[model samples]
Target: MNSTLSNNPAVVIGIDLAKTHCDVVGYDKNQKIVLKLPRISKEKLLERLTNMPRATVLMEACGGSHSFIRKVKALGHDGRLVNPGDVKRIRCGHQKNNMLDAAYIAWAWYIPGISFVAPKTQAQQDLQSLQRIYQGYMKTRIEFGNRIHALLLEYGLSSPQTSRFIAEQLPEFIETHTKDLTPLAEEALLMLRDSWLEASEWEKKAGQKYDELVRANEDSKRLMTIPGIGPKCAGALLTHCGEASRFRDSRQFAASLGLVPRQNSTGDRDTLGHITKRGPKHPRSMLVQGASALMIMADRLEGALGEWVRKIKASGKKYGVKVCAIAAKLALFCDTKDPTRTVNKKPTSAVTKVSGIFG
Candidate 1:
């Protein structure tokens, strides 16, 4: 594999990565094909790249792509990642295949203004993994809880006294309902309760892991200094955004989180609507939740942040709109990579002074 393409080295390479094998397409400086290989084993591809001269490698971001990018970077080559959507827009053929995908990935190198994803560190990836696991468990638990509630409703049972009845007094609730319950209904309720408990246990384990990891991470601690940014939010943000250095400024960071407004403009006029709501979804949603909590306690806030909240409220936007705007500001403040960067002349004093509420 190494000797096969050592003669005509490429300036750009594209990889369409799959489970076991990957398709690699290389192009010279003039967009001319230098070497093309399909279904090359991952081991052979790396072995071949290890022997070749350093060049830029491009790929669509997906499963296994980040790990490969990490290896490519370590091999002293520029490893760039493109959005699969972006590659599809530039790909020359109407027909889609591995070769075409790989070729356009290389061609995208020459297409100016295409955004490339930065590869994350092992630590960031690990934090992200823990957060995702916790989210999954919590989501499952909620589903099970909802199923229990629906089943109870089917039996003419009144709504539980509390929203969290499943986690609190679910066993007692089931016991009391035994008189009204049929055999199958009781069995289904018992199964769902057990599933909910299992999910809860796993969620607790994952949460503890997050707490341990975030406490040890100085950047996570620093990020927690901002209002509405907690351990979960910090962990999720780091997982998705890597370091604040990846973003040039706070606006870029907010935009990356899809906090910025969606743009739809024509030649003579400009239009803006709701946020694009793109990028890492979990952290963005978490930030919004944080912002909502902060707004509820706005009276307790002081200084610039308090005033900023008041101004947004006075703007007469809908409640949801105000929440999203606040979330965007919160994201900008979270971008402490450049602490000097501020939003709308409001300072961090407004953010940090009152953030202890979340603690």
Candidate 2:
């Protein structure tokens, strides 16, 4: 095993974390082991780190790391969450153990080009909780729609399979067929009707809160200014990313969200793969949905690039390619840019106009 942790001057800590316990390996700049400690309480971990002169703490980005990271920040020390996948790829030998893993995490942080995940704050936690609830309600609404459609198909009665249309016709359809329907079919219809009403109520409640959240935040407003970002998308993104400046660029932000495609190539050969969706699933999903919305309402986006995208779609390329392009563009749009390279432009007549649309 590597034994250089003790002698070096600048100390770095690697923590292999678990639910009830965590292992810490302390190393010096020369890679000598200064300390190899067993499972310790998070409270004690903070106390010990706080007592030290100052050092960098590194751990894998997992569920428990967030709170510890917040504590570490309060102690006036840097806390880095090394992506586990990146760490696995960096190990040089077959002798893998907890101590080596921790040390490697610290080493990875010191290396250039490897990215770290930003810790979420209390505000972000709260926002995520609310968004999850909203998403749950939306899922119920979709299930209710499916049930209603299925029930209608059983009878010779059918209308459009959209939420709005089904909701609008439910009451009238039920009233007209009340006497003609059999008892079992009527029971099923009644259940579907109740579910539909409940789903509508849930949607309204979630929508109201979502709108209020978007309106109350400056970051959400800033995100909304981008083409295709709506209230739900903006609110979710602003809440999830707590600190936009932490991302070095938009591409990093997009990559963090798993928007960029993965690539594996060889000499004189190339292979581009699907997006390595290895980050937070919710926000990445929200951004992709927002990108789809932007693609549909292309006229709302103000830029030559957005206009060009519309032209490509108009030229009869597949809709999927157009969607992927827009999602990639969205990643760039969210990034901070050099003022000299940025310009203002308007949407062209290539796309249909859409009202109340945001980037």
Cα RMSD of all models vs. native, in order, equals: 3.8, 5.8
- Could you tell me how far off, in angstroms, the CA of residue 39 lies in candidate 2 after the best superposition? 3.3
Write model 1 residue lDDT over 1-359, tens digit each, in one string. 32234456798999999999989989876667888888899888999889878999998999888888999988999999998788878864578988888888888899877888877788888887888788899899889888998899899986574536776787788788788889899889879988988999999999998889987876677677676778888777778876456667668888998999998999989898999998979889989998898788777766667788878877888998999999998876654445454433555444443222212
lDDT of each: 0.80, 0.71
Compose the digit string of candidate 2's lDDT tens values, residues 1-359: 22323444447888888888777888776666687766776667777777775788889988878888888878888887888888888786557887678778877866888887777787677677678778887888788888877877777777678766766776677778776667788778768768877977987897788788677876666566656667877766766575677776667777777777788999988887777886777776777787687667767646675676577567675676667667766656653554222314533321212111111
Error of 1 at 92 (Å): 6.9
Which residues of candidate 2, in runs, are more than 4 Å off? 1-10, 87-107, 110-112, 147-160, 164-196, 240-242, 269-278, 298-306, 340-359
Evaluate model 2: give its lDDT. 0.71
C-alpha TM-scores of all predictions: 0.90, 0.75
Residue pairs of candidate 1 with colliding backbone atoms: none
